[model samples]
Target: LPASQQEHIFNAAWGGSHKTGQLICNACNQSFSTNVDEVFSLYTTAIMNAWSFKGQRHKSVPIIELDGDYVLEAGAKLRIKPEKPLFEEKNLPNGQIRTKISFNSKGEAKRWLNNGGAESWLGRSLTPEEREYLLSLIKESEPQRREPEPQEASTTLNLRNQYRSSAHTILKCLGFFLPDLVCSPLTQPIRQFARYDEGDWRLFAVEPEQFFSLGEEITNLLGLGVYHNSVEIYWSSSSRMIVGILTLLNRVKRAVIISNNYAGSDKILYVFEDTNLSKKPPTAILAEIDSSKFCQPLLGVQYFAQPTKMYEYFYNELVGLTSIYNPIDAMKAELIKSLEEVNKHHTTLEGSTIDQYQTLYLNFFIKLGKVLQVSVDSVKIDSKLQEYGFSRLRLELKGRNITDPEVESIIVQAFDSVLSDWTQNRL
Candidate 1:
């Protein structure tokens, strides 16, 4: 491989530093970016934006279109994008006309009112007297505040292309970490399928029932959040197979089969990027592991016999995990935001402050209960509080003065106790 032909194997969108090598030719890199990488990136835009992940090239979060006349901006902020000014006029029998106009902001309303919007709605030129009368009748209304609600959106994805992209990514990692193995004849089929889409190869696989459970265990072991991106490649001597597992946001998991009959010694390469820490470069680990540690019995040839069934199973698994994790992530974000707000106003702890903290705690516990498939109520929470010797603190928090140092200490300890239980018991 020449210097000009070498290219960085990892996609910049996955939050990593760029390192060019002889892993892939420049032409193949560009082609894969156009065909495979773009599709997978589009499919993961929401998750990427939600986590505020910025790549080497893409430094800002992209706008996400919603179901209605709104687009998500800067990840969480919603902006209304109506096609036209919102205007309605009703003529009454008593020789009166009632008009209504809506705008996203007061400045927008003022701009529209000055830019012939009134004349357009009236369908005629406005005389000085008419304009003055309209101005006199119109009054500015106060802004309305409402609680945030869930948003619904639909996205069409090509799972086949995404699978290919995953396989290609694994191949790139191998090229960077184990160049000889990636260049060997054993990886030729993967190269043909991932680069040119030439073979009917079973590129990705998962045990439909055990995939999520296994993913959760791995996530806990790695101390990874939903925003982290990680990939693992290992050759299992016992199973005589080379497999690669790709995880995005700790939500989407897929195992790519790189080789079925391997003759090399046991090797494991793990690469990960914490999207939250954009300044840090991605980490790569090449280590020796037990020959039997990462073996997958389910990736045998028989598993690929029914491609349609496998695809369907993978599709359903993706959808189910997305539905379950997205909302929890949102809730977690809200909890963090609320906590920041509390810290910002920490000078005085009033009754309202206690109430706000309790509200935040209740909301988080409810979400945790739902995720754990457990019923949680005040009684159960109080029982835990009793175990922690904070049962009396809860009652004292209500009646005690806001300036009491002991009260604050008790509340903090109780909060810590709850969090400890959650982490220890998998709540």
Candidate 2:
């Protein structure tokens, strides 16, 4: 097939076509969702996960770059950066963007960059300390993000700091103090472990709060371990591998490792970490493998480049990383597992203007409920809420004298809590 056709097929395989219909994959036979949007969303995320892809816009703006190829990556707080560089940039009215990105070396960074990513810095450009500072400032200000606005930058910082719960941590930042023998493997495939100066040896480890305060960009490094609301880490003595544990905020109840691979296709990437009398118990289980039949996944995964390292690191650093958070009664807990994704995207309220706006919506729901005013249990204010109708109510409130400050204040509070309720009830 032609390269263009191959790329199109590759993109399609990752994300299905927009034309929805019943289709069966011989591989799974189970019907995959025929929805184009769902397919594309997951495709985008999976591609984004590869840490490839070139520069794309978030709301249509390109991000800041540190060099021709290297860019200051952004996280979800900034929408993580990819490993791309040296793409063209175009100055949009509101932001800058990379105009062209092809399959260049670092596995098509422009793709990732375009998908809410920036450039990645490997090797030594600055000390971890220096980078950490700039990352913190960027999180707070995000002054250099794709199409970042003054208000958005300031708001991003405030939200990060405010909700900066050490809960639901996907990965942890490491300090140089890892036991000399506990140092990260020298040749991990994952880019997070690229050797710095002389192998990432550090005499000092910065505090998490202090580190983020520095306001620079940070690269995400993966390790096997238990991550919960309180993130922590430990490593094996051989230095061949390490594990970490963390606590995600309440919002991100848990991270579901949808699929992972380790050991050529011979081993299924399950056990989050291997344990021995010397190694101690691990924190979570990343995959369960059929060590015997491990080749096929490799077929599709080959395009990922450096599969050995990625898989090796997967086995060594990310297996059994999740079992730590599994509930004692596994069967019963399954009920809540489905909500994990919802938690990931929603925010819990802390009194803020956004929260205030939520309160207004709640009041609308409440007033609407009263209009329907039936039984205490029967009136579902949110269920009947309509976007256009509600806005009309708000304008009518203000258009006349009925929407007084007291009513407005009530609306604001309801608005603040609205999202929380929506997530809670999906109302």
User: lDDT tens string, model 2, 369-396?
Assistant: 3333422222344433324233444444
RMSD of 2: 25.1
Q: What would the TM-scores of all predictions be?
A: 0.72, 0.19
* C-alpha lDDT score of every prediction, in listed order: 0.65, 0.27
**Top model by TM-score, which number?**
1
List runs of model 1 lying over 4 Å from the truth.
1-8, 17-22, 52-60, 67-83, 91-98, 104-107, 114-153, 203-224, 276-281, 291-308, 340-358, 366-379, 382-427
Tens digit per residue, CA lDDT, model 1, 185-303: 88888777788887664544433222123334556667676656777776666567888877766666667778877876766677776655454545677766553543443223334
RMSD list, candidates in order: 6.4, 25.1
Model 1 lDDT at residue 267 = 66
Model 2 earns a TM-score of 0.19
Question: In terms of lDDT, which candidate is strongest?
Answer: 1
